[model samples]
Target: MAFGKSKNRRRQDAAQTKEAVKGAVRSHGPGLLKAILLTGLTCAVVWGGIELRRWALSSPTFLLKETTFSGLQRAAPGELLKLSGLTVGQNLWALDVEMLERTMAAHPWVRTVEVRRHFPSSVSVEVSEHVPAALAVLGDLYLVDEDGEPFKRLQPGDTLDLPLVTGMDREDYLADEAKTRERFRQALEVARAYAATEPTKRERLSEVRMAPEGLVLVLADGTEARLGEGDTDAKLQRLSRVREELRARGLSAGVIHLENRARPGWVAVKLSSPASERSGASQ
Candidate 1:
């Protein structure tokens, strides 16, 4: 009976120790569960971030599929596309807009350029090109803008009824752009004056040759108008008057000199052979 009591006591002790261990585990159960949940959340976030990055980089949605150009006149689309340096299947977000603009604007025809990147796969471009105002006869003919900026070489396809500005050296212009530009401005003024005048006088303008003495106008009828350097407007007015008087009398002059600034009112005219003989025959 004593042995049996001792065995029962040992069983009781074992039961109590098991219960104590269970109680300890239960007390720390919430903290263990929270630690496991935090680790799982951190791992999930890292995995999700990696996947998002991968998707963003390799996704077909962000790839450049189309490129479009607008506001173009003289600029060729193929040349514009070539100059843009943008290619299909390129990354849209990786496009350098500034670099693209610089490259396109470097084209001879492009006056200004605006580059835009559209999301989900497109690029749009705005190109402003230089408009030809005159044909500048340097070594070879060059197209000059209204602002006197020489932009491009004359092509056979370009059939513009613009006036020619001669006696300008390309090297001289390259050496002194400012001086050349000033001369161009004066040439424009002369051209504009002709435009404003009557068609009879305007039709006579063939070429404007810039001379060291002044501006010389070479007419279609082999007549030369010598406009010396003083007041250009005054010179033009005198020229118009002389042209009108001569035209009214059905007379023609070989050289009309307005260079005598000392006698601004008096115009000296050298008659052509036909007109000279006619004047003599009339007198």
Candidate 2:
């Protein structure tokens, strides 16, 4: 009987110990939660204070500390800066770099423009100014690039020294892209081909006409070469060969025609055989 009573006592003691452990954990749960809350609040306050201090120390506006311009030969730095809408004491993030670049590109002389910010305070502008291939004497004094793309037009002045293209002037050249593109391509090809020739020949070459049949190259001395539609490469090659032969054999000819490859035609030599200034007779 005594043994059974002791066993009952031991079982009760075990149950009590298990309840005590559960109660201890339950009692400390709220305190543990409170400690965690206090720690999080302290961290939040410290973080907030740090942020406030940083905000106070930083400048309200990202002022322009320095300005740089590159690849701008004809364009004045001051003028371009003014046009860019970027100035000292302006907010860095507020500036629209892309819009500014686009605005600058609208100027006829500017071929390409890039605007970038040097964090905190500086803005740098780089522009590739248009090297005018020729001045299209259209209604507007359009400046044509080497690719014959009419980028911009303005009143003529000291800034440009390219050749003048005067023919079939129109106001809608820029708007009528299809027609203009064709004409521009032809002119570009002719100009490039002429440029590849000897210096004397290059100097003598005047204008290229985009005719319906093909392209016609008019020289400074009133002579013209007719190249049929397409296959300009072959025609230019023939002209070069014929020119070299004429120079080697002591001959002068007018209107060297590569229009018909089977039988190349030329006007008779008009001036003295080897005189420097050899003029060709009109056909």
Candidate 3:
């Protein structure tokens, strides 16, 4: 009887051990499988990416693709392309777009530039140029943009059809000139006003001399208009009214004084004496 009891106890103990082992395996099995699956997926993704990049770089057709440029005239295409530090047969995957754009913007005439990779191999460049607004007579001469900031040295004939700004010394020209630039602000306004009336007014603008009295406008016909520093809009309106009235009356004048706009409307207008009459008047 004692031996049978011992045998039953042993059987119960073995059964409990088997159940514990089964339970442990059930809990850990999914975790092991999941880890294996995740590792495999990561390896597959990394390998695919590397293979794709390698294939793209190894393709000869992409390396041989041609690069193109637009809106480039002053600078040679080869020169600008060289500044980008790009060459034929370079792996497109290794190209740095931001660096290329920064390099292109280094050009003096380039106001804005865009650089983009052309798929597998080549790069395309598009550039916007700076338009000259005024010319500053520095030692080497400088081209000033519309904002009155002097950017780069000028070449001969580069400032054709642009207004010439005089009377500023080298010190004023080299400085930022933001405050003094307002001196020409009214001149720009007048130039535009004339242009609105006549497109060829740009050719008529000879020089803008900044003097102690105020701004002076020298027209191509040797007619001078005194434009004071204050209340320019009012002054121009008065000038326009006077011009219209004179034209209606078939009268010609040379200098138009816009200095005083009192109740009496004081203005000075000139008429060129006939060549024969000028001799008699001088005599």
TM-scores of the models, in the order given: 0.72, 0.66, 0.71
Model 2, 238: alpha-carbon shift in Å? 2.6
If the candidates were sorted by their lDDT against the true structure, best first, what order would they fall in? Answer: 1, 2, 3
Local distance difference test values of all predictions, in order: 0.81, 0.69, 0.68
Task: Give RMSD (Å) of candidate 1 vs. truth.
Answer: 10.3
Please give, for residues 1-283, the per-residue lDDT of candidate 3 as tens digits: 9999999999999999999989988999899899999999999999999998888778775673667889886666777777877777777677777888889788888777887787766788888777677765656666767766667788775636666666676676447567546644555666666545434553366766676777766667666667655666665566566656656977555666655434224556664433311111110
Question: Residue 151 CA error for candidate 2 (Å)?
Answer: 1.7
Report how far residue 246 has shifted in candidate 2, in Å: 5.3
Better model by TM-score, 2 or 3? 3
lDDT of 2 by residue, 30-96 (tens): 9989999999999999999989766644666466678788998877877776776667777666678
User: Candidate 1 on 1-283: residue-level lDDT in tens?
Assistant: 9999999999999999999999988999889999999999999999999998788778988999988899998777788778877899988867889999998898888999998888989999998888887789879999888888888899998888777888899898999998898888788788778666636644557778888888888777777888877677777777777777788998888888878766766677777854463221110
Clashing pairs in 2: none
Using TM-score as the measure, which candidate wins?
1
Model 3 RMSD vs true structure: 6.2
Stretches of model 3 off by over 4 angstroms after superposition: 1-21, 138-140, 157-159, 167-187, 198-203, 210-214, 230-234, 240-256, 261-283
Q: What RMSD does each model have against the real structure?
A: 10.3, 7.9, 6.2
Name the regions of candidate 2 deviating beyond 4 angstroms.
1-61, 159-161, 164-168, 171-175, 201-203, 241-254, 261-283
Better of 1 and 3 by TM-score: 1
As a TM-score, model 2 comes out at: 0.66
